[model samples]
Target: MTRSPATPLPPPKARRRLRETAALTQTQLADRVGVTPGTVRAWESGRTTPRGRKREAYAKLLKTLAEEAAVQAPEPEPKPKLEPESRPQPQPEAKPQPEPEPKVEPEGKPQPQPDSQPQPQPVAAPEPVALTPAQAFDALYAFSAPALVRQTFLLTGRREQARESVERAFQTAWEHWPEVARDRDPVGWVRATAYEYALSPWQRLRPRHRHPEPPPADPGDRTLLNALLRLPPRHRRTLVLYDGVGLDLPETAAETEASTPATANRLLRAREAVAGRLPALADPQVLHRRLAELASNERLRAAEPPTVRRGGERRARLRTRAAIAFTVALVATTALTVRTAPTHYEPPVSPGQAVRGVPQRVAPGALSDEELELRQKLLDQMQDGPERLSPRLE
Candidate 1:
């Protein structure tokens, strides 16, 4: 019997390690392979695998890249040998110094005793748990979901929208759990994703159902939250990322998709707007404290696990209906306005003018004094009176 070809390497681990070794981001690798970033992510996360020509191409590309990397790697330089003159020399033995004698204390004077050695403080070790992919996702969800939902709520004034955005973001994280688990700042990644999702323009177009009113909060907090919602979305998001989420300026800028200077300007303008609404916010410490309290409250709330089945189809259907309704209403309004609008600038004609298709003018010489006086009065009325001229009969 013919021997079977050697089994292929596991694609997921090989693809991830190869991409890392080549210092290529998922986006970069996707670009090189002429595929979408999501496809690469799915492949790395084991959600899907490359097949047929694509598989062969992927394996070939990785092998070529690994070879190029190995060839381009720099050789290690050899260490220099030490010379006899540079080596440490042995020294002749020296005589030991005499110990100083302690003086005796005088009679009736108390002698000083040596201090007792301080005991070492015990250090608490971190819990050691090996995180499988599922466990890691669970831990991240437990830690970050509530806070992310709250952050999204502050960004989008609607509580339901905020919850939806957070859920979608977390669902994405779960899809790419392997990569997210290996990320340096998984929480930050999820938070940023949720923030972007909350701010998506498509979300604004979707028809929203009414939600139950929230429980009573501090009047001051309500005032501040209302003011925050009134702010431009960019400014509000920037402020929340910096103050509420405690991200540094650069991180906030990155999340907001703004330059550092622009982000700084937004933050400054947001602060001023808030201060204008709430005088207490003029004090930086007071502003910071309030934001911290809001964040703490959000963190303390319970979080539900994200829905396993994403609501993409439902949202898409709703969006389509909304678009159709908007279009129909827009067309109807335009038609109504056009139909009712005044079509011509000229006033209605008298019977004589209608028959002649022109206005009949009287000569000054043909007019009686009364008629002339009446015409002059009409002219004066036209120039100064508030009442408009009415059409006359012939």
Candidate 2:
């Protein structure tokens, strides 16, 4: 019997590992394969499988990319040498000063020595205590609110909208504290939600209110942030999620509602765009450091914890119930009004007379010639109305 063909490797694991090994982002791999980033994510997610020619092509491209990466990889740079003077040389000691002569004590009374003051010991800061779920949500809101607001501002390019989005997102978290507390990254969820809310078109429909001006951006961040803002919204969001927010590829993908491959592609494109606009960002280390600094600055500027009340969910439920009750009441009242209110007046028919299709008896009275003539005229007018117009020929 002929030897069987070797079993093919599973696409999801193989794709992920190969892409990572090659240091190629999902977007980069997609570019090479001429497929959408989502397609690559699907491949890695096992949502779909490659087959026949596509499978062969995928395997071949992965191998080629991996090999190319290996070939082009740079050797580690040597550490810089330290100069002798720069190596922390010891300073020479000064000669001891001549000692002062001791004064003799007078007569019989013992001389009292000078009283020494005790030095104050340095106090260490207390470590933060672990918080309960409710406490944690409050702390998270206090610490994260400003950063989230700033991030939203960057995304929305409007201070008022950003604040609204952040507030809405936090309120949502507050109302569902248990669920939010259980989330692996509550801050990330909040940030992602705020970003989504900021971008929603419905927000534009809300009544506008005057808001205080937002704080100024850091001088260092201004140029880079402006350049980032110039990118397409998707690209900007991806970059912020990855570098600014410090989310992993998968997390960023989920937050952005994109497939892993698509997210990767957006991140790659975002970086490229930013690098094109700001040459310093072309160096990954420099870019990472800058993003870290920006994130740190935002954290440092977070508002102090304020008193927070619980029962946000209860309040929301109450509001919902109130709205529903009001609607029902309004509907009932309108229905009652419609039922009881007097309708347009209609003439009372005689007992022997017919009104529409209902027969009634008429009163015994003889009709005058003028009355008959008036009735004929009224009938003539009804028959001569617009509906009796003849159709015009073209």
Each prediction's number of clashing residue pairs? 0, 8
The 0-to-1 C-alpha lDDT of every candidate, in the order given, reads 0.73, 0.72
What ranges in model 1 sit over 4 Å off?
1-129, 209-216, 295-394
* Cα lDDT of model 2 by residue, 103-219, tens digit: 656775555567779999999999988887667777788778877876776666566677667777777777767867865567876886788788776765766633434443787
Model 1 C-alpha lDDT per residue in residues 1-394, reported as the tens digit of each score: 9955543534454656677678787778888877887777667645566876676667778888778778888988999999999999999899999955555676756556677799999999989978776666767778887777777877776677777777777777776677777666788778878877888888756657334436327776677778888999899989898888788885675555444578899999999999999997898778878876654554234345533323433555677999999999999999999999999897888565335567689666688899999999888875665887699999
What is the RMSD of candidate 1?
28.1
Best by TM-score: 2
Indicate the worst ten consecutive residues by lDDT in candidate 2. 299-308
Off by over 4 Å in 2: 1-133, 157-163, 202-220, 295-318, 333-394
lDDT of 2: 0.72
- TM-score of decoy 1: 0.46
